[model samples]
Target: MSQTLQAIYAAKRKARRFAVQGIYEWQMSHNPVHEIEARTRADNAMHKTDLGYYHELLSEVISNADVLDALLVPVLDREISALDGVELATLRLGAYELKEHAEIPYRVVLDEAIELAKHFGGADSHKYINGVLDRLAQSLRAAEKQQAK
Candidate 1:
């Protein structure tokens, strides 16, 4: 990749990392989303992250959590309550991208979520995250998936 593209990719990855942590904090503490965003920003090296994408993911996912869960629940092997916090947060992020960010390919959403799960969740959690998001993409991005074939 070119230097500029690599920098942008790194920034986005950092954003996803911070967003996952912020979402995980929100899930565990039920704190207000803005507060969580503020606290996360204050604690992190914000210049290295994609602040726009981080804000979008953190705010949108928290605000639309119920809707995201409703879409995810059907694809899950177990109940939503059974999901680990990290996996749940990652899945929520993926679901939000799949649902609201159609400009992003479903494959990219799933790949990013899987990477998040591997980095933050349990040893085998990426598999579960992958399964759920894969199923979600099928329905949520049916048109895109069809066209890609």
Candidate 2:
């Protein structure tokens, strides 16, 4: 891939990492998304992150959490409230991307969420994330998935 493309992907990955943390924090603290975003920007080295993408992911996931949870409900093996914090946040982020960010491939969303789970969730949470997001993609990105096969 070209250098520019690789840089874009790296920036997006940074955005995902920070967005997951922000979402996790919001889940735990009930803080406003803008407050979380401001705090994150102030506390972290976000120079390399895709700031717009980070903002979009953090804001959209938090704003539409109920809607995202509704989408996740059908595929969740257990109660949504029973989910681990990291897993819930990662899944919400993944589900949001699957449903709203059609420009991003579903596989990329799954991979990124699995990475987030592996980094921040309990052991084996990545596997669960993969399974749930895979199911989500089937429904939300069915056309893209069929074309990829």
Candidate 3:
């Protein structure tokens, strides 16, 4: 990736860290997602990692969460209701890139998210994540084609 895109990926790495932290906190507490979200953004220091891209990406993903979840369903074969909160969050972040951020190559986004899943999610989470992202990317291409026609 060029310098500009590299910065964005670095940001995504940062965002992933924050997202994981925020999601973990949400899991541990009854505190609303918004409260957790606000806290994450409020303390830029929480990112800890050098990547500002993470800050931007996490903020955008959380900001546009509804649409991101919509894209997530088709990619997920199992009922989305079955997914735990962390799995749900991972899928949404990966889906957000596949559907909305067309600028980032789909493969790169999926790979990064899978890495996050492997590190932070359940042991099997990466498999589930990869499967969903692959399906989501294919559907996104189909949607683009239909729109073009």
lDDT computed for candidate 2: 0.94
Query: What lDDT would each prediction earn against the true structure?
Result: 0.90, 0.94, 0.71
Is 2 or 3 the stronger prediction by lDDT? 2
Q: Each prediction's TM-score against the native? A: 0.95, 0.97, 0.70
lDDT of 3 by residue, 1-149 (tens): 69987765676677676776665464457466667767766777744454455544556666676787777766677787788777777787777667767876777778887888888889898998888887787787666535545
Judging by TM-score, tell me the better candidate of 2 and 3.
Answer: 2
- The number of clashing residue pairs in each candidate reads 0, 0, 4
Candidate 3, poorest ten consecutive residues by summed lDDT: 46-55
**lDDT (10s digit) by residue, model 1, range 1-149:** 89999899889988889989999999999999899988887877799889999999898899889999999988988998988899999999999999988987898888999899989999999998988898898999898888889
Error of 3 at 119 (Å): 1.0
Ranking of all predicted structures according to lDDT, beginning with the best and ending with the worst? 2, 1, 3
List model 2 lDDT by residue over 12-118, tens digit each.
99999999999999999999999999999999998989999999999999999999999999999999989999999999999999999899888888999999998
Error of 2 at 2 (Å): 1.3
Q: List the residue pairs that clash in candidate 2.
A: none
Query: What lDDT score is found at residue 61 in candidate 3?
Result: 66
Q: Which residues of candidate 3, in runs, are more than 4 Å off?
A: 1-8, 23-34, 41-56, 142-149
Stretches of candidate 2 above 4 Å error?
Answer: none
